[model samples]
Target chain A: MRMAELSRTSGVPVPTIKYYLREGLLPAGQVAPPNQASYDQSHVRRLTLIRALTDVGGMSIATARVVLSVIDAPDRTVRQKLGATIGSLGDIQATGDSGGADRDEEHAQAAKTVDDLLERRGWRVDETSPARAAAAEVLARFDRLGHHRVIAALDGYADAAELTASNDLDVLAGIEDEDELVETALVGTVLGDALLAALRRLAQEHVSGSRYRTPPR
Target chain B: MRMAELSRTSGVPVPTIKYYLREGLLPAGQVAPPNQASYDQSHVRRLTLIRALTDVGGMSIATARVVLSVIDAPDRTVRQKLGATIGSLGDIQATGDSGGADRDEEHAQAAKTVDDLLERRGWRVDETSPARAAAAEVLARFDRLGHHRVIAALDGYADAAELTASNDLDVLAGIEDEDELVETALVGTVLGDALLAALRRLAQEHVSGSRYRTPPR
Candidate 1:
């Protein structure tokens, strides 16, 4: 297949495909005798994944590159793909937004809160887990706003997270083919985030309707 | 009261606040005599929310503007605020990334899937809910990838979403003051998304560890 066919089949633009190729996000095609290069089924699949990550998952090009590397590497296993993709997805935020003079005190309190949450949940994760740090950062911000009550919402959030992860891993473990496993892991990591976010929005609306009886003002 | 004080209290840089002011994302502070403008507690709170939405939630300034407007509007009710914020938050992506001729067919199918999902879940939402469209768009992308398997994860994702939203609305309904209510709604809507995403990542790690007994590659 030519580049045009790759774009056509994948529903991605030709220039976008070229951009991914140049950025090394998509592997290069076989250079033919002429100027044209021939793309294969793998190229189409790769381009499809790239679009799903960027357009649906809202991951940046750089982050997508790292995710793809973990997914496509010869030695990449399901564990590496899951760890790296989840970590990279957690990286979709600007650092240092919680700057303040009491930063040290706030961080200390936040760390304790995270630790307490972990201890209560009895989840065995590493000290350096980005999700733990990310959760702590959110708690620190809630403290900053003089809205410590938001921290009370964490347990419910954690319960939902645990249940969802259990479901995800169950589906993952059932896959027999390594290639299918990698593809499922990648798609689930990327588009799966969007799916969850969308459902949450809908649920928010439903709950809000019942919580507040007032009409739209 | 001064710009420096506002920055100190909010932990947001003066220039960023000024940018927000210039961009109308932040309302102008009161202009006192001696060419001095004084910001109050409201400014600090609003500024903090803006930073959370932009930095932590990864929402663009433009989207944040629409959100803040809805939340801070003089005529906004709990109903209006929830509907508008959740709707705008769904606009966090660049629309129409799939640039092929089959976009209409893809969208038609996506819309049906969203409708079916809503009906199955017995969710009560409007015809024009952006969450529905966002979910549809994601399903369409999965279709484009020829990876229909991704849709299988939607039910589990919906379960997590419902639990999180119920928790969020419960916390939100507990606030007595309208100002406090609006603030919590804004912070929770933005930061809550990140918190859930982070928790999901952490849970993914825990599940993956137990699912695959093999070591990381």
Candidate 2:
């Protein structure tokens, strides 16, 4: 189908489609002729996934790129994707303001920032290393909390992360294939938020006890 | 100690501290001699937690305010806080973006938009309700995918969220005091991310089958 058809069918604009192509966020369409390209249903589906990561998951473009790389790569494992995503979460966390703005531009800047962070860390990722760079962006946000505080927290977080990762891995190992993966990803995203909410609630019971025992004067 | 001393010790700034006080993000300090004010170690600690949420956890000031409220409110329960946080997450998702800029001003605007959404939802929360508009925000992103494609997905997400919350509540139920709560919060915050990271890794194996049976061509 033509670009317009894809746009009409997908609700993404021609310009935006072009932008994704340029950014390598989307694969190049089949050459129809003289500067025109054709896209198919797969392109539309891919575009939907891209939208899911950036728009719904709040991932920056670079992080989304790494996620896509893993999803698309036949050899990519769940562990790599998780590592990449955990790193990507940091990227999302780094955005100081959750403004409604030019997503494409923000994504571009985020990608560059992620690249700089990976370089600074001396990470051995290729230029196409989306996960490494995505992780770097998250680390950079961790960096922005100021060196001392972030450093203090990073050690504790890393330690805790190891334990949690093991538990989660156990859960994932039970699931079987691609369908389960998407279902699990969807579940994980929402469930993760819910889990935090519940824990915060549960923690409050304990938090409130301090108020009674150590009344402030 | 005075605000300056608190700042030096906690690595928080006087202006930011002032902002917190004005916004009720921080507890009021004791007024000292000659129109001066004094803060104690607890204030410093609270400030640190505030910074972690904002800088590391990427919480908005408004959301931070609500979270702080829960922490400070002596009467709030584990169940209430948990429910509130879950509710707040939905709120945050609801008001995340309305489609606008990529900078601070736009972020502020988006925050305001979220505030509006919470108001519309009639949630008993401040403008800072972290979850006030989060769910809607997530939904909005998927709006581009068209209603039919995402409604079921959203339902699936909600279901998963409920289950995760239940599990997390179980974890929090064991804590007996504030110290434990703090420890739990810390561990949960860090480990939770790791757990999700692990689960996401495992889930990737099944995503292909879950999203659609046919490979995009």
Candidate 3:
């Protein structure tokens, strides 16, 4: 198909498609005679994935480019691709020791808490995984707020997280094509957070409605 | 304490503190003398919440003000306050029928999937809950990407979400003070999403490592 058809099929505008092409977010289509280009089904798929990442996942174009590069990399194994893809999504800064002694102590405590949680669950994750730092930052935020009660529920949250992660992997296990598997994994990891967060709010509303229903005047 | 003290205590800068004050994100302090005003513990707590909403939660100042107002409003019940706070956070536009026929049909189908999921789980969320629309949007994105397998895992995700929501409310149940309860709920609801997303990534890394571990070359 030509650019117009590709835009129509992918529900992206032509100028936006050109912008993506310019940014190398989408690959160059096959050049036809007289300066015309032709796009195939893969371009359509790439456009869809790009929209999903930027629009729904709220990733910046630069981050999406990194993720796409990892996806398009031919040499890496599926596991390595998956690792890089997840690493690019969160954008959480790693916990550092430069915030003076008080913060350094707090960050150390939070890191220990995360380390202990991983140990208690016996989960095999790299020490430098951005998720570890992200989780530690959250713990530090809770501590700063003086909400130890929330921290007390860490085990429950971990249990739920593990269950959801298993479900995520199960979905990926069913996909046979390596490219589709990686794409689906990236989409699932990014959009899945929004899905779970929305569902959790719905569930919270349900519980709150039943538990704290206001009586009629 | 005064402005400098509040800034030092909260680690928010003086100009930013002034910005929040001018923006009505913080309440006015008591006039102590001819030129100075004095702030108390409440100012510090408010500053912490303000920073959490904007910095950690990534909320706009306007939205943060609305959330803070809901927290500060004494006339609303706990459930109403919680509902309003959650509603303000996600910022998801509700599914509408404005995107032509095909999109309208897709959105309607997505909405049905969400409604059925809620019914299947016997959840009592309001029809207008933003989460319902947010979840539906995620489903629609998956549909657009042609990844139905992710949708198939919705039940498992919901199960995990319910468990985590239960844990959230249990923590809220332990807070005796109503003001503190609302404050804690707001913080938990906002930051909990980040925490859970981080933990899920960690869990995914663990599962992927164990299942797809690359043997030594």
**Judged by lDDT, which candidate is best?**
3
DockQ of 1: 0.58
**Candidate 1 lDDT, tens digit per residue, B60-155?**
788888877887788868656656666777754745355555778788988898888888987777778888888888888778776665576677
Off by over 4 Å in 2: A1-43, A69-217, B13-23, B31-37, B74-82, B90-217
Cα displacement (Å) at residue B49, model 3: 2.2
- TM-score of chain A by itself in each prediction: 0.87, 0.48, 0.89
Which one wins on DockQ?
1
Q: What is the lDDT of residue B52 in candidate 2?
A: 58
* lDDT measured at residue B7 in model 3 versus the true structure, 0 to 100: 73
- Provide the lowest-lDDT 10-residue window in model 1 chain A: A91-100
- Compose the digit string of candidate 1's lDDT tens values, residues A1-217: 8988887777777888888888989989998978789999988777767877887787789888887887778876766766676676676465545455687788789888888987898766777788887888788778877776779777988999898888777667778887778777778766877878888888887766656653643
What is the Cα-based lDDT of residue A136 in candidate 2?
41
lDDT at position A105, candidate 3:
84
Instruction: Report the C-alpha lDDT of model 3 over A1-217, residue by residue, as the tens digit.
Output: 9999988777888888998899889999999998899999999888878887777666667888889999999999986898788887755633111255776788899999999999999898876788888898888888988989989899999999999999998999899998899999999998898899899999998876678774422
- How does candidate 1 score on lDDT? 0.78
lDDT, model 2, position A73: 66
User: Which ten-residue region of model 1 chain B has the weakest summed lDDT?
Assistant: B91-100
Q: Rank candidates by TM-score, best first.
A: 1, 3, 2
Tens-digit lDDT track of model 2 for B92-210: 33222224342234345434544453344332343333443344344443343332233333333333333443344445556677644543444344334433343333233234233
lDDT of each: 0.78, 0.50, 0.84
* Colliding pairs, model 1: none
